[model samples]
Target: MRRGGDWKRGTVERPVGAPVFDPTDERGEETERATSASPRLSSTLLQRGKSDAADAEAICEAASRPKLRKNFVPIKSPEQQGAQMLARVRNQFIGRRTQLANSIRGYAAEFSFTAPRGLSRLQQLLIDIRDDTTVPNLAKELVEALAIELARVHDQIAKLDKKLMQLHRSNEMSRRLAAIPGVGPIGATLLSIKVVDARGFKSARNFAAWLGLTPKNHSTAGKNRLGVITRAGDGMLRTVLVAGATAVIADMRRRGSRPWSWLKDMIARKPPKLVAIALANKLARIAWKLMVSGERYRPASAVPMPTPT
Candidate 1:
């Protein structure tokens, strides 16, 4: 078995007593796993060799390995898939809205009008485009059409956001994870639905590494070296977590929240972006603990501190 784009739709039930192994194809670990499972060398391991038959043989061989069964990708429930689809659609609309906004701004700038930075200002830009007799009517009509589309997209996004909030409120795990700083409805629900079993990870560090928040190791001959994040799994999850961390950092900077002392100290030593990644990594761990222990997050201080609600 392989976890590709179609696996969610095309996957069939595993036969009785048949082993399953989902090749993490995007990570290029498919052939490696095959090699570990069988005596026959994978086509990927051979120089100047490739064929569909060879690939099938490799998969057949790998399926016989007793250790391969644990690597199967978790089957997501319809609700989980729905939530993920909602988030994805919301993200798509957000990106489209941004593109439309920038297009409007760029058009306005050409006419010596500089719109203020904010989505709320797009309406004013539309007004300016329509009323500015100095501007051509054709350009005005096109900009108006784009503005209409943007408004519709915004409305759709708002509806999806409400749905996501509903999900966050309804799911106990999502609520518990949401109690952690830098873990909001989006982040919490994403993890709650996407991660089938948090205990499958041996430790918090493993969870963070799976999320690709930890630094990459490149040590040799007793010389230790580390690099940027490996970015191994679920790029969208990592992105949202980092975004939540960024919001937390901004709030800490504005309100001087004491609960974020660790973030502040890290900022003093490292760059703000680096601090955000570090905070996201820690948030991943906290989320894992909440999932495994089935406990709500308890803030360290009595003071009312501001974070994602």
Candidate 2:
């Protein structure tokens, strides 16, 4: 109805087909539900993405890692680590033994009693000195002290030997390697430990190079000059190899067998030290081939003869 020319108020109405709930109240409810679910969804998605990425990266890294030929294998085992430790211990004992022997000799020389050259002979001399009434009391006391020190070093060496023997029995490779000529318990144990894997080397030459057996080079202007072995690898192994070679060469000479022709010539031309080093290098190469091929040592004659030239 109109009153004094004023129009009547129209009715308030919502949009057609809209929900019947209050707009402000419905919006608040929807926001609360979304806020609660958002964190969990995001976290789940992030974790899934991270895992997938990590898997892909791992696969790629593995593919990128360096690999040898198909037949090559890497040494990766606790047994190898154990073998290395034993070698180190044995080497240490040997060094200590040498030091003690030298010290005993030097100490005895102060009293005008020259110690014998050999270890066993030196020990006997020390005992005789201790028992001799002719020696002054002060000299006798000093000799006794040196003897005690020598005994202590020997005990340590004995313990190391026991440990090495135990390892030799436990390790199949060590036992087999010991069967090779010139490779005693110490050599076998050290070799087994020091050589992590045969597969790491492509050939026998490569293995010998690792032991620093290959000749060193210093060449210029197309003139090739060679020097002594680099001696780059395990010092203990190198020392053992040299000592073994010296023994072999000595035995060969004693037996009057044809010495390695080169060695024979060198003995005639060079000093004893140089010849020993040369033989050591040859021995190292021989050892590498034997170990790599799992073959036994054969004398030159045992090898088949070449056809007539």
- Candidate 2, position 60, lDDT: 38
* Candidate 2 lDDT over residue span 1-309, tens digit each: 233333233212223332222112323432111001112222323424556465445333333334412122232345565556666776776777788778777777776677557788886778777877877999788767777877887888788788878887887767766655456767877777777666667776676676777779999999999988888666888788778777777887798766656677778998776787777666656666666777766756322323433
Highest TM-score: which candidate? 1
- Model 2: residue 128 alpha-carbon error in angstroms: 3.8
lDDT of 1: 0.74
TM-score of each: 0.77, 0.65
TM-score of 2: 0.65
Q: Report the number of the highest-lDDT candidate.
A: 1
